[model samples]
Structure formats: structure tokens, C-alpha cells
Target chain A: MSRVVVDVVLKPEISDPQGQAVLGALGRLGHDSIRSVRQGKHFVLEVDGTPDEAELKQIAETLLANPVIEDVELHLTKD
Target chain B: MRIGVLTFPGSLDDVDAARAVRLAGGAPVPLWHGDHDLKDVDAVVLPGGFSYGDYLRAGAIAARSPLMQDVVTAARQGLPVLGICNGFQVLCEAGLLPGALTRNSHLHFRNRDQVLQVERADTAWTADYAAGQRIVIPVKNGEGRYVGSPADLDRLEGENRVVFRYVDGNPNGSSRDIAGVASENGRVVGLMPHPEHAVEDLTGPSTDGLGFFTSILKAVVNA
Candidate 1:
């Protein structure tokens, strides 16, 4: 079995109130170097075998992330 | 006709949806999220609530439930389906409708009586009103701001898929004041407002939302 990690993120143009709130908290904690912070979803999928990148991209685009408001990044990770 | 109202874990409006269906002269069928069957309902209603406890994202978890697969199939086949509040979020997550409902830009959960204008009256759930007709209904949600791709919004506008538009101020920072939207075929509708909460005068709000339920009954009969 192979493991694939999918990272889903909101587009830059979309307003992320939750992320902004997190940034506010970070500022309160004295993280001066970070100007902005965006939140995203991460999913690890157990695949049948070593699936090709196309298959992973297809799964991310079609099911894991909504293309209307988010983008996706797929990578293979080891156990 | 029998209208199916699906109840997911944490659902708060299934009973109200079923009541509205019965009031609209249709038999109300209770459907469950884990069930794969729809029981041959004439229409389906995804009622409001914090499904999956709004985990991951609002309605994101419940949208992928087994019952939603059947609802998606029926919706594609032109079954009248209404998604209210959290259900609207589920519809977008399920890809049965375009656009996504993000957290309100104001960073607050808004609950109030809202007025909306009917953008298109030909849809399965809006035929009871005239185009541009305004009605007051209850609007409530934390993540009700509607966001969509620019090109897709243009396409929806060009094709008249924008079913309901906010008449007053934008309640949740939704683009173009969009309160609700319909599928291109007009059989599926997703709105952030709690129409089921305003179906009757006894509930306090105007009975304008009853039109949504009645329209679906009429559509099923005509079909």
C-alpha cells in the first residue's frame, strides 16, 4: 500500500476569516516575522499501490478539494 | 407525492422540513444519512444543522455521506432538491452546486429575518413567485458567505442560475448579494437561509418561505 498526502487551500482572493483570526492570535503571541497566515486542509490517503501522479491529482481535484474555492497539492509520503 | 427529508447527525431542521412538505400537500419521508436508498421519493430536501458537528468544514463531512450519493444521482435526473442553511454548504461540498460558503467576513454568526428577491422563477423551487418578487425569510449561519470563481459566476448569471439574491445589505459578504443558487437544470437549489424555519406564521416570520415547498410539490405534479 502507498500513502498520498493531499493539501487543500483556499484561493488567495477568497476571504479567510478563520486564517485571519489565527494570524491575530499569532501576533498576540509575538510572532513578528509572519505577516500573513492561511489555513488549509491536509488529508492522507491509503492507496492500493504506488499510484501515478495523475491518479493522485485526479483524486484531489475530483473529491478531496473543491476547485471552486480551493487549490490542491498532492505528494507521496512514506510510512 | 412523497418528499424525502434527509437527517444527518446533528441535523436540527429535518422535522421542520418534513412539516413543510406535509403542509405543501406531499407525504414526508424520513431519510437517513447512512442509508443508501431514497425510498423512491418524488423530491429530496437536505435540512439544516451542524452535520458531522461542522467538522473539517461546515457540511463538508455530511456531504460525502452514502445518502448524498443517491441524492446526487436523483438531482442529476431532475429531481427537485432543496438545500437549506447547512444543507446549502453540503450541496456545494458535494459538487451538486457551484460556489462555496465560507465563514462570514464579519466574523460573526448572523441570525435575522432577511429579504430576498427572486432572480428566476422557473426553477423547480421558485415557480410559485414572479421574477423579482421579494420575500422575507429567516437567514442564519456562521459560514454563509457565498464565494465562487469569477468565470463561473458569470456563467451562472448568463444562464440565469442565480435563483435568489439578497434584497437588503449583503448578509454574509456573499458575492453579488447571492442568497441562493440553482442548478442549470433548475432541479437543485441551495440557499443559506432557513426557509424551513419561516414556513408558517406561527413560527413568527412571514409565511413567504412556504412558497419554496409548494413550488416543489407543483413541479413534481407537473412532471
Candidate 2:
């Protein structure tokens, strides 16, 4: 068995209000040195056998993230 | 004329869209997201609401539905299509329109009556209104802000594809105060405001939204 992890984040140019809110909360909690916070999504997929990088990339690009505004990264592991 | 209103699993505004069509003197056909058929309707309307409970993204899942495949194909061929609110997000996700609607810069769900200046009156859905006319409609959403690369935005402006621009004040911090946009051929339009909710004077902020439905009827007749 193999496991695939996909991480999706809004492109740097796109504003993330949720992440900004989190940063605000952190500031209120006295984490003054942190300059930025950007929110994203994480997905874990379990496959029956070995995971292919190209197929996983296709999945991430087609469904996991929108290329127009978001970037995606994938990591695979054997189980 | 017959106009189709799509209903996804969590769509909340399909009924309202149909009512708007009826009020505008067009027959409204109900379409299902799970179906591949478009029922040969004259035009299509993707209504608002949190489809698939807005999983992944606001309109991500719904954009990949069976019906949307047909919609994307038909839209490219110059079919008149209107997308409202969540439907607007779906249009962007489906690549029928440009730019993506993101969370409001203020990070809040905003609901209000917004004034918009009509920039292009030639689109299938905005032909009833004169250029530069201002209309009031209901704007409601958390992820309604529009974002795009600077060059793409410049290109859209160069092509005069921006259909509506928010006046009075920008509600969700949309770039250039854009409230709506049209496809290159002006057959497809997507906006974050609920024009369907504004078709009736009794229930809406104004009856201005009836023009959207009426415009499409005229577009079909003239086509």
C-alpha cells in the first residue's frame, strides 16, 4: 500500500483573509515576531499499491488545487 | 423562451432563479447537477448556495459535476449562461470565466444591497440595461472578493469584458471594484451579487434585477 499527501496553498499574490485573521489572533496572543500567516489545505490519500508521481500531480492539479490561484505539492510514502 | 436553472446538492437559490425567470416572462426549467443533459434550454443559470457544503472550495466540487461538463462545452460555443454568487465561483472553477472569487478581505460574511455600474451592456445578460447605468442588487457571501494576475486583469479590461463594477463602495474588495465579468464572446457572465433576489420590488432592494432575465430573453429572440 502507498499513501499520498497533497498540500494546497493560495498563491502568494492572492490575499488570504482567514490566514490574516489567524495572524491577528496570534498577534493578540503576543507572538509579535511572526510576520506572516497563510492558510492552506492538506489531503491524505491511501492507494492500493505504489503511488505514481505523475498521476498524483494530475490529481492535485485537476482537483486538489486550482492552478489559477493556488499551488500544490505532493508527497508519497510506502505503507 | 425557456431558461434552465441548475440545482446542485446544496443549492439554495435555484427556486429563486426560476421565479425570476417566470417573473421575466420565460419558462424556467429545473436542471440537476447529476444529470448530463441540458434539456435543450435556451439559456442556463447556475444559481447560488453552498454546493457540496462548499467542501474543498466554495464551488470546487460542484464545478466538476456532470452537468457542468455540458455547460462548459456549450458556453464555449456561445451559449448564454449566467452564474450568481456560488454559481459565479463555479463558473471560474469550471474555466467558463476568468479570475477566482476569494474570501472577503475583511474576513466576514457580508450581506447588503450594493450598487453596481454597468460597464458593458452588450453581454447576453446585461443588454437590457444601458451602459453606465447603476443598479442596486443584493450582495451576500463570505468568499466574494475577485482576484487575478495583473496581466490577466489588464487583458480583461482591454477586451472590455468587465460587465459590472461596484459603485458607492466596494463590498468585498474585488480588484478594480469589479462586480461581474463576461466571457470573451459576451455570452457567459458571472457575478457575485444575487440578481434573482432583486427581481421583485416587494422582496428585493429594487426591481433592477429583472433586467438580467429580460435581457437574456431579448438576446435569444434577437439571436
Candidate 3:
């Protein structure tokens, strides 16, 4: 089995409704100075079979990430 | 069947999310973000809302929630996982799906009923619709545009992974006018619109969103 690390990042300057809502709630509670906010996900996986970069790429495009709103990186993690 | 809807500290739509699941003829289980268990639900939904207050990023924080460990595991095991809006952000952040949600090109929050073309209907969450069907659903979000490198976008298009695309106008300036996507396994799906809010005619803008819920049900039953 091979271990892989995947990281996804959202594009910059997108309005984050969740973040804005938090800032709004915080401001209502008297906290301030929040300039900006964003969100993303990171994943580690262990898969069986011969490690193939092509298969990994397929995973990234199909299930691992949305090409439209996100960018993803897949790295081989030495076990 | 039981469907789990995860709720993080900042989640805004857990109740509505659970309601949608119930409306679709499944039991809705509220899974806590800090818990690492999925309650063995048949399917999972990462509902839209400000999880972790969108701190660090829209889904960056919630992606690391304790419950996500199980979500990732179940998804890898071929369980159906659907992420909507903020949930879509979490899926990308959790590395359960590809692509990323970015700020709208206009840098403004958009909320309206948007029309979308179903590009792929083979996923566990989208099997009920035809490939070329157009549906309307509620889409309210701050960071919703989908972006990727030109080459990467081409790969997605070439592979038929682009599941949903905007029909009338690009809502958030997503490249290729993409609206949603699914995993190659057809077990997982993620989208920018709020399908849960469109299940009923009286409450939802149109009944088009019901197909999403029904699609998953059919996929699960068939599997």
C-alpha cells in the first residue's frame, strides 16, 4: 500500500459567507479587526496496489477535488 | 436508511439539512464535528453553513473537524458523500473531492435561485436526473466561484467529471461555467447550490432539487 497526502486550497479574495457570518457574530459580541477569512481541507490516504501517478491524478480530479472552485496537490508520503 | 449530516460549531443549516434528509425518506442523524464517528449512516451530507466560522478559510477549519476523519474514511470505502456550498468547501479542504471554491469575481455574496445544467448523472447523488437536464435551486454564498489552472480544468472537462454547469449565466465566475462535480467512483458529489432547500414545491423554488436526494437513494438501493 502507498500513502498519499492531499491538500486543497480555495482561491483568494472570495467572499466567505461562513467567515463573514462569524465576524458579524463576533462584532456583535464586541470583537473586531478581522480583515479576511477563507477555508480549505487536507487529507491523507493509504491505498493498495502499485503506486501510479496517473491513478493518483485521476483520484484528484474525480473524487479528491473540484477543479472549478479549488486547487489540489497530491504528494507521495514515505511511510 | 440513515443519513448523517455533520454539524460543526459554526454550522448554520443543520436543522434544515436534517429536514431535507428526512424529506427524502431517510433518517437524519446529526453528527457532531468534534466526534470521530459517523454513526454508521448509509450516506453523508456536509451541509452548507459557516463551519468553524469560516475561520482560516471557508472550509479549512471544518475540514479538520473530528467527525471528518470518519467522513474521509467512509468516502474512501465507497460511501456516498455530498457536499453543498460550505460543505463543498469542506470536501475540497478535507481532500475528499477536487477543485476549490473561491470568492465570487464580483467579491459579493450572491443569493438567488439559479439554473444549472446537469452534466453528469451517474454519481450517487445525481443519478436521478438526465445528463442534459436543467434544474433550478437556491444558491446563497459568499465564496462560491470555482477555479483551477487551465490545464487542470481541461483534464476535468476531458474526463467527464464536470457534473453540473451554470445554464443562463455564470453565478460566481467559475471557469467553464462549472457548477458542480462528482468523484470518479460516482460515490461522492459536491456542488455550489443548495439542493436541500429545493425538495418541496411549496417551500422550494422548484422540485428539481428532489432529484438529487432521490438519486442518492437509488444509488444506495441499487448498490
Candidate 4:
């Protein structure tokens, strides 16, 4: 099985309202970098078959991330 | 005509986009974001959704998808590609079209039926529309504001590339109330509104949005 890790991050200067909302909530909780946070999702996919790293990277580029709003990092691990 | 709708991992509207293409009398081809092949589709539609879960920016990461490389090549070769909402975000990230879509100044997720004026009927996806004709379509997004440098905006205006403009109100604070635009070749078009949802009369405020799909068919046939 092949496993892939995808990291998504927002662009600089683009205000993340969702992150701001969380920051506000966190401040109320007394957890303070918490000045603001940009919200993003991370995915770990385990493919059943052997797909080359190149093939997997293709999927990450086209399907997993949109370059305008998010940047993605792909890491492959063999178990 | 064969239409390809790219499905990114977080893409929300691939099914709806495929349905819109089929309803418009074209074959809908489901293309994976990872695959480099376009599957011999004549046209492509980048549907709305929070691709990559709107992770890095919105459409930023998805613009670099393996399939998008092929998309960029095909688009340059004259294949018509339409980007709606987040898809519009992807197109700009890919540099397939000019300008960028930013967050609304109001900083909220805005959703509503928006009226737009068809500003450029000469484009491939807008041939069925008449200049200045008002059409209603759904606009929904948080980072939906359209932005560009003043010089570029002037150039777009001078070059007549502005395809659509908000008619009644600017929902996302888009510059010059711009809602949609097309590439110089007219083969690549992107808009902040959701035209796919408005194609069916039963689900749509009006059937005017179907004209965008039909316009591409006609453009493909005539080309």
C-alpha cells in the first residue's frame, strides 16, 4: 500500500475569515500565534495498489490542490 | 460535443457540472485532476467547490494539478474552458486567465441570485448572449471578489475582455463590478458566479444560464 500526505495552506495577504473566527474563539478560551490562523485541511490517502510516486504526485497537483487558494505538499511513505 | 469536467479532491460541483454539460446537448467526460490526459474531450469546465478544502488559498493548489497542465495546453490550443466560482480561482492560479479573485471586503460567505450584464458576447462561451443583456445566476463564495492592478484593469477594459459585470449590486466587491471575463482568444473564460446551477429551468431562476453551455457548443461547431 502507498500512503500520501497532503498539506494545504492559504496565500499570504488573503484574509482567512474562518481562521479569524477560530482565533476569536481561541482567545475566549485563553489560548494565545493565535493572533490569527489560516484554516486548511490535510489528507492522508492509502492507495490499495502500487502507483508510482510520479502518478501520485499528479493526483495531488490536479485534484488535491488548487494553486490559487492553497499550496500542497506531497509526501509518500512505504509500509 | 464532448465536455470534460475536472474533479479535484475537494471539488463540490463535478456532478452538477457534468449534468449541465449533458443537458446542454454535449457529452460530459469525467476527468481526474491527477490524470494528464484530457480524454479527448472537446471542451472543459472547471466547476465550483472548495477545492483542496480551500486549503492554501482556494483554487491555488488545484491549479497546479497534473490534469491542469494538460488543460493549460489544450486551452492554448483553442479548446474552450469555463471556470465557475472556485474554478475561476483555479484558472487565475494557472495563469490561463488574467487577474485574481480575492476575499470580499465584507469578510463573509456571500450567496444570492445575482444579475449580470453580458459585456462581451463575442467570446466563445458567450456567443448566445447579447451585449448588455441582463441574466440572473447564482453567486456564492467567501473569497469571490475579483481584483487586478489598475493598469491591467484598464487594459482589460480597453481590450474588451470583460465578459460580464454585476448589474444590480456588487456582491463581493469585485473591481468595476466585474463578474466574468474571457482570455484574448476567447477560449478560456472564468466567472465568479455559478452558471451550472442555473441551467435548468426547474432549479434555476431562469434558463438564461444554459446559453453559456450552448454558446460553447456553437463555438466548437463553428471552429
Clashing residue pairs in candidate 2 are none
- Location of the lowest summed lDDT over 10 successive residues in candidate 2 chain B: B100-109
Off by over 4 Å in 1: A1-3, A26-33, A44-55
Cα deviation of B108 in candidate 3 (Å)? 1.0
Worst 10 residues of 1 chain A by lDDT: A59-68
Candidate 3 per-residue C-alpha lDDT over A1-79 given as tens digits, one digit per residue, 9 for 90 to 100: 8898888765453345556666677788777776655556788888786678888888776455655555688988665
Sort candidate 4 into its docking category.
incorrect
Q: After superposition, how far is residue A41 of candidate 4 from its true place, in Å?
A: 16
Model 1 residue B189 CA deviation (Å) reads 1.1
User: Taking the tens digit of each residue's C-alpha lDDT, what string does model 1 give over B73-188?
Assistant: 87888888999999999999998999899989889989899999999899899999999899999998999999987888898899888999998788899999999999989999
The interface root-mean-square deviation of each model, in the order shown, is 1.6, 0.8, 7.1, 4.6
How many times do residue backbones clash in model 3?
Answer: 29
Candidate number achieving the greatest TM-score relative to the actual structure: 2
Worst 10 contiguous positions by lDDT, candidate 3 chain B = B98-107
The residue-by-residue lDDT of candidate 3 on B1-223, one tens digit each, is: 8888888887777787788877888788888989877888889888889987777568977887778987888889898999999999998888777777777876678899999999887788887899898999999988888876677778878888999998888878887898888777878889999998998888989978877777777777888
Error of 3 at B191 (Å): 0.4
Model 2 bad stretches (over 4 Å): none
The positional error of residue B198 in candidate 3, measured at the CA in angstroms, is: 0.6
